[model samples]
Target: MSSRRARFGVFGVVALLAWGAISVVRPIPERRAGEVISGVRTPAWQERVDSLQRGETVGGVLSRGGLTAQEATEAIGAAATLDPRRLPAGMRITLGGPEGAPPSRISFQLAIDRFLHLTRSDSGWVEHEEVLPWATDTLVVRGEIARTLYDAFDEGATELPPGARSELAWNVADIYEYRLDMSRDLQPGDTFRVLFERRRGPEGTVRIGRVLATNFASGTASIDAIRFESEDGRGRYYDTVGKSLRSAFLRAPLEFRRISSVFGMRRHPILGVWRAHRGTDYAATSGTPVRSVGDGVVVRAGRMSGYGNVVDVRHANGFVSRYGHLRAFAKGVRSGTRVAIGQTVGLVGMTGLATAPHLHFEVLVGGTQRDPRKALASTGGDPLPSADRPAFDRLRADYLALLQRVSTQIADSN
Candidate 1:
């Protein structure tokens, strides 16, 4: 009986020893700080992915997405093969592990023409060269005009960069090259809207494409989308239905500039005598470049008595435009050359019988001088075709809407 009892005790001791050894030898999962405990097994840590948007600096991207600077740097170092200092904006980075675990893996996507995959491995990140989906997005920009076109854009929440605004205004002038001039008739409350293309690069950089639709309003006068075409057929912008918005001639030749004198009788400032001022005087700086009001053949290009350097352009219609008091003529702008509207013809100057530097401009109808400011006869051209008319209507509606919206915005701000 004693031997049997002793055997049982030995078995019990051996079982306890075995159990303790097993517990010590078995691998245990590490518990990390900031980790949530649920029952016995630890859950796989997951983190929300962050956007790699263009224009955001490397530091900005991480900070904006709830990452500390140290963590972002460490993660970038661990996950990406590229230098973290050179990381561009618009890069997508995924972080996994516990809330604060170093990034396990970093993936890069080349968003250029197409998506090419790049993944990090033991050897470091390398190009995977996988194909990705190509996608395009569209946005609508609308606004009204009050005080100024820039103001209208601001009111519409479509404010553009200075360079962009300058480019846009230039585009508008080009479209209306023969019909309207931005330097002259863009009134205080002119409103407009532009629909155009925007391209995203591989690094999430944004690139602006051509203008698709535009509507401009000045006083009661307005111009809807008159033409739309892209040199590259990647995109299109027209009215409700597709049609061209381009016109042959812009309505005005000048934009946002004041007329210092008219083409009529006026007192001569330099001569100190009353005389007939046969040309309109555009008030501009001495070096301000003068542009041709319409497309025409240069009939005269040289110096004239009391006119200083001059350029005369003959249009298809029986109309002629004369630029006088020019400091110098544009290069290659000689007689017999074809010049387009808005093409630099000469530079403003105090030449000829003038006291101050200005552009002495004149328009002649049928070889007779007429008031260039008052003349409204369309020099001979067909209106947009029936197919394009619907597009124009839509453009006009958009402009009107933008103008109204801008007006409302201005009123609200006031």
Candidate 2:
């Protein structure tokens, strides 16, 4: 019996040794499909990234990247969830495939920090949004407004950079647009200070982001705006006490090339007769989009004599606004249609009594037309909600410190 048990134990040890040798000798099987999808066993694919040229189409770009027409079509269709039609020129595009093989993965920027990723799958192709790496750097630009903001940057070494200078002006103007008329308010002696964070690409090719905090002193009137981003990533500018800086209405109905005429009496351009011009005239391209200045209900839409195509919106506190000289109304917009602030109502055109393409804007109180400039003198946006005070206070303290440091540097330099 002892001899028999010894023989059985030796046999078990030999079997275990044989099993270990076999495991070492045989190769493993190919990775499972789930492993590939989860990125555990990806192919040794090569990648190339490029920027889209002007007038480049997705299919055309893909075809140039070695994709067949059919492959391009399938990829585009699969990535259609990203609404690729809105992709602007200079967007980054990346293609991935095995070395010496056609690309099976395509990624393109739909926005600065957002990417649309498309990969070939057994069922066809799949697409999703992948956030690209984005970074922020705090930057400061401080100086007095001399002539114009752009000109202020045109000087010697002290001058602001072209794009950066204009960006600072636009952002600062946006903050003060409600309280100051940019056309008539800014002067040579006025000083300006801005501390903004520049959101940049991974390569740091670009500079400038949203305004973090700003201060501009024009005469005795001064304004302060601090940016606060909520937990969900929504950002807005507010005063120290937490009131929103955005006016209830946008200072301008639309971005205009120039203000052709101001409100009040003027020599009628067409008739050459002095008459009361109740609205401000903004000269812009014929196809420029015209936006409503505030949230309101469209009270009147369609034509009127001389005024031609027009839209009238009524807002809270007995305020009424008008947009005129539009080429045509936006689809589905009519009397009683609800519109939000900055909603496009129509396109700019020379539809009325004007000789050139322009928009005529007006504001009314209690049925009497008032200067649009006066109506925009006050920022009518609500204060920061009480619920947001705690979060806002913390952000405000941080920004104020940043602003103070930059301001001290500017003063010392001068």
Candidate 3:
């Protein structure tokens, strides 16, 4: 999240950034170019569902659902690997047969997308790990920004999982991080059309797949990004013509954190003076991962007056970025070490003159401090590799047509 000189504390900003490794681990499976898929699957074996009650054991659920006591015991034993003791109340359990019968299988969530599937084997009940079978579909949603992008999509968000909602915002912000300051640039009347892959299960659980393409428009600013991958399996967002949507630098080194302060004249938080604030402050919990916004070499990774622990990365085009008030530098990251864009360089902290944990981020162009927002955006990078162009161009045309249809639908509705 980016905003003009914010009054929110530093810790508020950095903790706001990342949703954790869970975001990547659960990402919707990537689709190759020209793949067209849109629909939900209805599995015939999804025959029953029951809720786990407080103080109810797996054996109890099994018995109540029609398994004989001995069968329940054997099934529970087989599911021991999942530690049934930790089963949360209200957990939904799906079965492969109707009530009053020994189901062919019992499935319970292990985590997002993962499940513990208990089945009857030749010898006895056995447990097997399973992941939900997803039916990927194209989801077209258009919303006028009321406050944040999340709020725009809040109408039907209750049906989606917690991670889905958080990831939707994260993905949207990530796609436009370089082009727009999410914390500040999103306007109330700005409208967005998101064309993405939506994965649904037989029981109706749903998650955001991959963001295939996005078109966002505000008063005067607009951005369009299409997801594309190369033969080597490296996927990134690119524009219609295949220009990389990624700039050489990231808008912020951290995830969803609000901008607590910006680069400009301001009242110093500690010094208590009307002075020039040379850096931006992102509030976050201590130890939130701080990243290098661009590929560069660490120029400094230590302390300075009022700056606390710091890591400065020097990039090409006479640009240098500083991350102060770090809890610690990332291992093996020090002066002269090469770093890549979005690589962890340090952790947020309050090691220097600060009241709370936060990352003090600054960007210097030609050795002069500039607004991190503008400085990061100026580094627009290159296009897709020449070899990937033909594939990307074909994909781009398809996506643009889909976006056009969505826009037309919106116009007709209005």
Top candidate on TM-score is 3
Give the candidates in order of TM-score, highest first.
3, 2, 1
How many backbone clashes can be found in candidate 2? Answer: 1
Score candidate 3 by lDDT.
0.76
lDDT tens per residue, model 1, 1-414: 999999999999998987888867875569899887675756566655676666565555655555578755654555334565555566666444454544444345444543333333576534444454333333345656555544555455353454455455566556554455555556665666665444444555444545655677677865655344334443333333433333334444344333333234677776788977775676777877787777889999998998888999998775888888899989999999999877888888877777888787788888888877555333434444576565557665654455444232221111
C-alpha lDDT values of all predictions: 0.60, 0.76, 0.76
Q: Candidate 3 vs. truth: CA RMSD?
A: 23.6
RMSD of each: 12.1, 10.8, 23.6
TM-score of each: 0.50, 0.65, 0.67
Better of 1 and 3 by lDDT: 3
What is the per-residue lDDT of model 3 for residues 1-414, given as tens digits with 9 covering 90 to 100? 355335455656655654465466575588999986687654444456787999988778877777788887778888767777888998878767633446878888766678888887788877889775657666666678887666776642444577676677678788877777676567788888777766776677777778878888888767789998777787799876677877777777787643343333567778887877776777778888988888998989888988989888999767999999898999999899999988999988998888788888899988899988677774455967898888888998888778767332222111
Candidate 2 lDDT score relative to the true structure: 0.76
Model 1 TM: 0.50
Which residue window of length 10 is worst by lDDT in model 1?
405-414
In terms of lDDT, the poorest run of 10 residues in model 3 is 405-414
